[model samples]
Target chain A: MLIHELLPLVGDAQSVVEVSQSGDALRELLRAPAASAYRAYVPDGEKMDAGTVVVAFLGPKPEAHIDAETVAPALRELPVGGRALLLLGWPVPELPYHRLLDELVTAGLQVLQVVPLDKVSRHGAHCAVLAARVDRLAPLRTHLSDAPLDLAGEAPDLRALLRLTGEYVFGDLLSRPLRRNLAAAGDRIKEQDERIRALEKEIAARDATIAKAESRLARARNDLADLRASTTFRIGNTVVQGARRPTRGIVSVPVGLVRIWRKRGTPGERPGPQS
Target chain B: MTLLTDAEASKYWNERHQQETDLRSGGDISFDEATNYMFYLRRLTMLMDRVGLQNNPVAPLYLLDAGCGKGYFSRELAKFGHQVDGIDGSEAAIAHCRELGGGPRYHRTTLSGWRTPWLYDVVFTVDVLFHILDDAEWERSTRNLASLVRLGGKLIVGDWGEDGDHVYGNYQVVRGRDRYLPLLDACGMRFDGWEPYRFRRSPIGLYTFTRIG
Candidate 1:
């Protein structure tokens, strides 16, 4: 399954240079078209033909550091425009592919495809990475894009490439103005929140005033209710009404006045035991 | 059918609030005070995630609390670093909001008549719109709230997501998606999604829209 993915990148290359940990599986796959020259991985400082396809099947194992350094010797043999197919063993998800991709980017390789080989993926072989060295950069598809799986390499769909490019650019364009608007909107909201806080304080002050006025009115109402319920005030008011009517004033007014004088001060205040 | 007028609806809420507890006046009647608050907070948290405010946003957002009965959502949103303006028609509700201070600004205005000089990043009404039994007033309030959303902003309304309208007692008129989608489409509001309250047997949920143009 690893060879199924690697053979397309190695299609009819002038020569094949493989630094393989997966044994002769890839060599067998390349034997069909029979590349003009085939050999083991090149030694350090040994350069290969510019168009040679380098296949590094560095399988995974516990504690193995599969990084750019692991693939640097093979990359040194690759000239500009030369492509590389790396079958990396991903031990755990903690070791993300982005870390390896970062290494490859530093090593002057552009990762064109990263395909996870579920069917024939060996114990440590997590995925297949097809990459090429380029002289200049093109508008990148997202850092992690799995949509371009057209590995046939027979007729590259220029239209689909343009469409993906357009979509990414358009989305970026939309977000630019939106981010600007959101920033401006955020400033306005901050101002408005400050205003809201100020208004809340104003409302709170007004509420305090209203509450104070309400408590005063409640106290006044209680005092009025108590006065209306008092016997002396009720009787005095009756006597006054009777005096205003006509003949009842003589006894009503004098008796009410004498009773009030005897009672003195507050009607409910009992005279201290004649002390 | 003879439904309660908007003024009568306001009066009914005022009278109800005079006797009902605060949570009962504003939230699900079936829930106790603590449950209601927790339920409301959970929903609000999820809503914050949807509107990109769960992380204490980069900038404060302008928010409108349409028909903010008792201003529960408005105050909670303010706590999330957003500026909120709460508008309601009930004299008692606005008085309560004003009494519970230090958050959103309170306005004693009907949902159909609440107009602000600037647009908002979010305009939301939670379980408050169905209480508008008058069809005309309900339409007016929906349109007015939609008009207040700026481009790329959201308008979230709490109601049903079914095809037909339903009525509950003499107070609530739950309008379905049939009545909402067309009007919002005409207003250039794109329907985002709808999710249910999912608390219990209740069918009401939130309908979200965004103004794209």
Candidate 2:
């Protein structure tokens, strides 16, 4: 059976047993250890002998059939320090599992450990499994006598364990590529920031150039105003204010003065239309 | 001449016509307004008489009031002993036509969709062609109007001649004199003549054509 091949992966077992109505799946446990035993039991009919590790493979039942009466009696029949591995395919609601665990403890059994097994298959039908051990039933009398039963453990029920495992697998499948893409996106954002800074610097340079051109234009206008104020510069008949004095040879004359001088014909002869 | 049946067209024009009337009247009903209405009716009667329509009544003259806003011209033509019909896409305009006392049977529809019940002696569309958005719709509408006119029947088109884009009330159009003549000629209608009417006051020109058979 495949279970024999798979049990080695779970580490060593001193005394393994398979208790199922049908001996097919139980036959797989024959390869666990040489001391392992297998048994088949009818519902509510058998009690385990001393020091036997009772591995019970109960088949599917209706949700209403799973009560303390149906489970506690069989679990109480186990001897002290004798381990019992019970397999079930039902989902346990909150507070109800605690009550059921309390009833099992009250029935002269000490629970050493409880393990939930996921990914269960029975001749191709998917199911969940629960495994527990019976510690010394005598020490249970003083263990949390006044307080409530402490069934808190890391392992969840079989259904929840399977769901959690599947979710882990799916989460890894979805987020691994997303994490890579996010790193690439962060790099692109940094590159864009650099480009934006470069563009800002370029804009600042262009703005400075525009300011320089404006200042130059203002200075040119001031120079033009100064040039227009000269006495040699004449607009229509008016003379400008600051210019060279009118001397004999190198005098700078206003345009109107030049025209008048030319009209007067060099201060002597008649002005013949100022040829 | 063009027959049109549009379901929503009439109701839309009717509402618009009501609103326009409300705005135009401004809640005033003076004797002067009544006199103006009567004067318009008398002028329309005289025009119809001059057209020889009053003397020899024409059954279903197949008149198309191009831009027949509220069917003002159509209603008058119908009252003057002509079996006339008008079509306009404006809901308010169509509603006004329906409200008018003893006017033509008016339809609220577009020129592109008008289908004449029979060939018409006169297919008249006034001040409507330039509202066409493009040359394609204009050509199609013009051809459709021209096709309604029987051989030797008159096709009258009134629009702005030789104008840049201009606005009148809510209407905007671009038109010129030579713009439509070639198109009309190609649609089996011969240009009879055109008369310039109200150049300064209205800037409108009325062109008359006849189906060439």
Candidate 3:
């Protein structure tokens, strides 16, 4: 479809000049249509006749993107007023490549229509920039290209003025939602950040309150322990317990009081080894 | 120091504006005058060129300097023949702006609370949103500013272009792309691009968007 779709734009070809690297699928797609097709694996400045369509597909196989070194030779071989059909394949993201376009235009090729190749094309190319060699530069409508979405393998290219659009449009329609989603996700992140900050503050306050209560509880427990270990409380408890029986109070009360009196003066906290 | 409450932050900024009379009051106070003159002002001039305002675009383009600190940008824009209005939360800042005004009308108003009848062709908030410590306030401010821009108008803000929000010191928080993009997209504003200031160690820059009908 790449050759068939562009065959009309090629016009009445006196001869077809096919230029590409050796063993590339692009060379196989180069059809002459009623003229003898000349193959140049590595073009070494072989000049051709006028009305010859220089058919070439430059893919990013051994190199990165389309470079001038590979493209210039094809232009060098192309005679004046001849047409050049180039299928450009990019390894980078989908976007308006002005640098590459400007390079082609500067090379004395008056770009006619840029046909963007689909996924199933013989060569997996970004787009086909169709142009003819002209003497003077021509006026342009728009730099951007678009066409109706075609399921069929028919070649597509050139449409719409990008800068003149009502809304500023970009290259990929698919990435639009992605960009929005990423942005919305950021909003959510900020919201979550606020929530996290609030939660952390609440947690810190709760921790302080918990610590204060624990300290007070510890102080109260210590006070109760000290009260129970007092000598007066022990003597009082003994007297009360002995008082429950008649004669027991008389002996136990005096004994408890005497023990308390001795224990009060004792230096050791608990009875020593001898005691 | 810890992050300040909204009231405390407002007080801090107002007091700051009152204390300093020069560019140091609103811009980076640490930077010397030479550095500011050579780097800071030059960077802004370049950005204005990128914004399509440097060469004097269509005359008298209505513009709003959202959160215009001390009214420098607003005054500068007004000098370009555009009707400019500046609003800031700091009372002292607005007072300073009015006293030194070349042309712009100054108003003392917070970004979130800012409400007006007029819609501007360009509403720009530079190095301001990061100062709003509260997240909800930041969102509201961004949304409100976007709302202020008429269709086919521009809304430019200064913030980090990278992903994820970053907190610096007490009052500064750099909200990333996720925080800004989705919200603005929902507002029908197509993002133009984000260009970094690229001065000193600063990662901050201008994020530009154009509202669509």
Per-candidate TM-score against the hidden true structure: 0.45, 0.35, 0.44
The lowest-lDDT stretch of 10 consecutive residues in candidate 3 chain B is B50-59
lDDT of 2 at B202: 49
Ignoring the other chain, what TM-score does chain B have in each prediction? 0.93, 0.71, 0.93
Which prediction has the highest lDDT against the true structure?
1
User: Which lDDT tens digits does candidate 2 get at residues A126-194?
Assistant: 221222343422211110012222223333334434433654576677678877898899899999999
Scored by CA lDDT, what does every candidate get? 0.70, 0.51, 0.69
> What is the per-residue lDDT of model 3 for residues A220-263, given as tens digits with 9 covering 90 to 100?
77666666567766777788878797588889888888888888
Kindly report which residue stretches of model 1 are placed more than 4 angstroms away from their true locations once superposed.
Answer: A1-275, B54-58
lDDT of 3 at A144: 21
Rank order (by DockQ, best first): 1, 3, 2
**Positional deviation of A65 in candidate 3, in angstroms?**
55
C-alpha displacement of B175 in model 2, angstroms?
Answer: 1.4
lDDT of 1 at A158: 51
Give the Å error, residue A26, model 1: 43
